[model samples]
Every structure is written in structure tokens, then in C-alpha cells.
Target: MLIAFNKPYGVLCQFTDESTGPARPTLATFIDVPGVYPAGRLDLDSEGLLLLTDDGRLQARIADPRYKAPKTYLVQVEGEPDEDALAALRRGVRLKDGMTLPAQVERIEAPDLWPRNPPVRFRKSVPDCWLKLILREGRNRQVRRMTAAVGHPTLRLVRWRIGDWTLEGIAPGEWREVPV
Candidate 1:
């Protein structure tokens, strides 16, 4: 079984919370599918498409970086990026982990997206722009860090697609099982 979950911001990716702090929302609250586990993770601060599967081989194919599955994100950054910044992203930016693989990036119009609870802050002086970034490698906070390194800190981040799956009709906090 394959499941695509539109994970909401501030929600934990895992089914259970291991932290000792006050409880936060988790996948268990939304997903009731037995034996299915998240194929990959989206940070607590980020939102959008998350894939889960009950099949181990399918899970590995989705999560493993070796598969080079394209993951697309719609990023709202603080400043407008010129061609130079876009080129830098395309060429690959050096992160603490190492140089990132060249990414597919382009400036795009703001996506029609669901409203985020505790919405991203608004700024009058600092103009923001939207970017569509596609990456094959899954690194922790890589997209956020990459944008920040290029002088445009991300204001809001949404993973729009993973592999061939997308958040097309799914609303935040909604999950739908799809045929594998």
C-alpha cells in the first residue's frame, strides 16, 4: 500500500513522539494505516507532500538517495534572486555537510497554497519571491540552508512533489491512499 500525506507545518513526521516535552501533533493523529511508515521526512517547520508505504522495497526506493528521485519545493525567500543566485544554486552550493549536487532551480510566481496556521510573517520593506527548487538528494534542512546561503532566507517552504506524486488536490493534514 502507498499513501501520500500532506503533512502540515508544526507536525512531527514520525508516528510517535519520543521527546519528553509536551505532546505535539504526529502522523498517528492523521494516519491510521497499519504497517505503513514514512518513506522520507519533512521537518517540523516545513509542510507538504510526504510518502508512506507498507512495502519495504518501495519504501527504500522512495527514501534512498541512490534512487535520485526528484523532490520539488516551492520556496518563498526574503529577497529577489538575480540570475547569479539562480546560477549558483544550479551549480551547487557548498553546505556544512559538503557541496550539494547541482539543483534544478527557477524563480516562479507564488503558488496557490493553503493558508498556514501561525502564518509566515509579513514584511513591507523586504520583498519576497517564490522559487521552484528540485533536488534529488535528501539532506537535513538543505533547501532552507541553500536559500539562506544565497542571501535570501526562506520565509516559507512547501514540498510540492516527490517523485511522480504531488500535493495537487490534497489539503493540509489530509492523507489519501493511492495504488502502488
Candidate 2:
């Protein structure tokens, strides 16, 4: 079985959280399907499409970086990105780990998305803009780091697409069975 889940912010990618702090939300809170596991991870702070599958081979294909499955995000970033900044992102930005694979990035109008709980901060002086970023690599906080490297820190990150699947009809905290 394959599932496309719209993961909400503040929800852990795993089924459980072992930390000693106050109880935190996790996949288990939303997904109750037995034997299904997340194919790839979406950070606790990031929101959007997360795939889960019961088939190991299918999960590997979706999650493995070697497959280069394209993941698309609509990012809200601080400051307006100039052409140079966009070019840098398109050409690949150097991060602490290494230079990332060149990404497909473009300035886009703010997407119509569900409101984030607690909401992204609003600044009166600093200009902000939206970017459509498509990447083939999945490194820890890569999008946030890349934008920061280009002098535009990400304010909000939302995964809109992964490979052939999308968050089209999935609402936040909702999941649906999809064909593999």
C-alpha cells in the first residue's frame, strides 16, 4: 500500500517520539495504517507531501537519493531574491557539507496554501518573496540552508510535489491511498 500524506508543521516524521519533553505530535497521531512506513522524511517544521509505503522496494525508490526523485517546494523567504541569487540557486549553492546539485528555482507568486498554525512571522521593513524550488537531493535542511547561503533565509517551507505525486487534494493532516 502507498499513501500520500499532507504532513502538518510540528508533526514528527516518525511514528513515535522518544524524547522526555512534553508529548509532541507524530505520524502516529495522523496515520493509523499498520505496516506502512514513511518513504522519506519531511522535517518537523516543514509541511507538505510525505509518502508512505508498505513495499520496501517502492519505499527505497522514493527515498533513495540515488534515484534522484525530484522534490518540489514552495518556499517563502526573507528579502526579494535578485537574479544573481536565483542564478546561484540554479547553479547550485555551496553549503557546509558540499555543493548541492543544481536546482530548478524560480520566483513565483505566493501560492494558495492552508494557513500555518502559529503562522510565519510578518515583517514590515524586510521584503519577502516566494520561490518554487525543485531539487533532486535530500540533505538535512537543504532548502533552508541554500536560501540562506544566497542571502535569503527561508521563512516558510512547504513541499508541494515529490516525483509524480503531489499534495493536490490532500489537506493538512490528511492521507489517502495512492497507486504505487
Candidate 3:
């Protein structure tokens, strides 16, 4: 079975016993079904669609770098992205690991977004806007780092879609099982 979970902000993706950190609940507490693990991770600071499955192969197909599934995000940044910054993102910025694959990105209006708890720091001096970023690879804090690499720093990040799956219908912290 395949599951699409709407993970809320500040939730851990894994079911680890790492008590050292603030005990944020993970998928294990909510989705009790055995033999399944998350396909990929949405960091504790971000919120949105997460896929889980009982089959390792199915999970890998979605998470692994080889398949290059499109993952879309709604990013709110500190300043307007200049043409050159957009070009850098399009061309793929060089990271410590290597250059990220080019991304499809465009600015968009803030679409009646739900407010996040313990909201992002407000910067009245610097203006902010929303951008839709679609990348085909999974990297740690890649979206945030990418935006920061350019002048515009990411103030808020939310995953809206991963391939055909989405955050639609599901509320924060909800999960449902579907056939593979």
C-alpha cells in the first residue's frame, strides 16, 4: 500500500528514538501500519506532502536521485529575486556536494496560504513574495540553500506536490493509505 501524509510544520519524518531533540512526534505515532517508512523527508521547519509505503522498491523509486521525480514547493522569500538570481537557480548553483540540477521556477502571488505556527520572523524593511519552485532531486535543505545562494533568502518553505501526489484534501497531520 501507498500512503500520502500531510505532514505539519515541526514534525519529524522518521520514527527514531532520538530523545536528545525536542520530542516531536513522527509518522510512526500517526500511521501505525507496519512495514512502511517515509519515501522522502520534509524537514521539521517545512510542511506538506509526504509519501510512505510498505515496499522498499516503491519507496526508492520516489526518493532516489535516479528517477528524478518533480517536487514542487511554495517558497516565500525575503526579497524579490533578480533576473540573475533566477538564472543561477535555472543554471543550478554549485553546492559543497556538487551543482544541483536546474529547476523550473517562477514567481507567484501569495495564494491565501495558511499561517504557520511560531511564524517566520517578519522583516518589515525587506519585501517578500511567493515563488513556485520545482526541482527533480532530493537534497538536504536544498530549496532554502538555493534561495539563499541568490540574494533572496527563503523565509518560508512548503512542499505542494511530488509527482502526481499532492497536499490537496489532506489537512495537517493527516494520512491515508492507497493502493500502489
Candidate 4:
């Protein structure tokens, strides 16, 4: 079975948290279906579409970077992005790890999204803007790092779409079965 889950902020992508200290919220808290596992990770601080599946082949197809499934994110950055910054992102930016694949990025109006539980900090002095970024590869904290490299640190990051699946009707902490 394939599932689309809207992961909330501060929740681990995994079913369990093995680290010491007070247990952080995990996928198991919201997902009760047996045998289903997350296809890819959405960082604890980031929010949005997460796919899960019980089938190993389907899971690998969705999660593996080799398949190059496009993932889209709505990012709120600290400063307004100029054409140079946007162009850089479009051409692919050099990250500490390596050069990223070219991404489709554009300035966009703030998207209508659910309010974050704790909320993003309001900085009166620095201006902020929204961006729509589509990437073919999934790298750890890539969105955050990409924006930061372009002089616009990300204030908030939300994965809006993954391949053909989206968080359209799936509210935070909610999941629904989808056709394979």
C-alpha cells in the first residue's frame, strides 16, 4: 500500500527515536498502520509531504536519488532574492558536499499554508520572501543550505509536492492511501 502523509513540524521521519533525552515526536505517534515505512525523510524542523509504503520496490523507487523524483518546496527566506541569486539556484549552486543538480526556482507569493505550531520568528528589520523550488535530487537539508548559500537563509521550509503526490487534502498529521 502507498500512503501520503503530511508530516508536522518537529516530528522525526522514523518510527522510533533512539537518542537519549526526552523522546521527540516520531512517525509512530501519528502512523499506526503496520508494515508501512517512510519512503524518504522530511527533517524534524521542516514540514510537508512524506510518502510511506509497505512495498519495498515502491519505497526504493520513491526514496532512491538515482530515480531523480522531483521534490518541490515552498521556502520562506530571510531576504528578498535578486535575479542573480535566483539564476544561481537555477544553474545549480556549489554546496560544501558538492555541486547540486540544477533546480527550478522562482520567487512566488506566500503560499496559503497551515500555521506552524510555534511559528517562525518575526524579524522587523530584515525582509523576507517566498520561493518555489523544484529539485530532482533529495539531499539532507538541501533547501535550507541552498538558500543560505545564496545569502537568503531559509526562515521556513515546506515540502509541497513529491513527484505526482502532494499534500493537497492531507492536513498535518493526517494520511491517506493512494494508488500505486
- Model 3: lDDT equals 0.88
Model 1 bad stretches (over 4 Å): none
lDDT of each: 0.95, 0.96, 0.88, 0.95
Clashes of each: 0, 0, 0, 0
| Candidate 1 TM-score over all chains jointly | 0.98
Which 10 consecutive residues of model 4 have the lowest summed lDDT? 162-171
What's the lDDT for residue 50 in model 4?
95
Q: How many backbone clashes does candidate 4 have?
A: 0
> What is the model-wide C-alpha lDDT for candidate 4?
0.95
lDDT of 4 by residue, 87-150 (tens): 9999999999999999999999999999998899998999999999999998899999999999
* lDDT for each residue of candidate 2 in 101-130, tens digit (9 for 90 to 100): 999999999999999997999989999999
User: How big is the positional error of residue 175 in model 4, measured in Å on the Cα after superposition?
Assistant: 0.7
Clashing residue pairs for model 4? none
- Per-residue error (Å), model 4, residue 121: 0.2
Instruction: Name the candidate that leads on lDDT.
Output: 2
TM-score per model over all chains: 0.98, 0.99, 0.94, 0.98
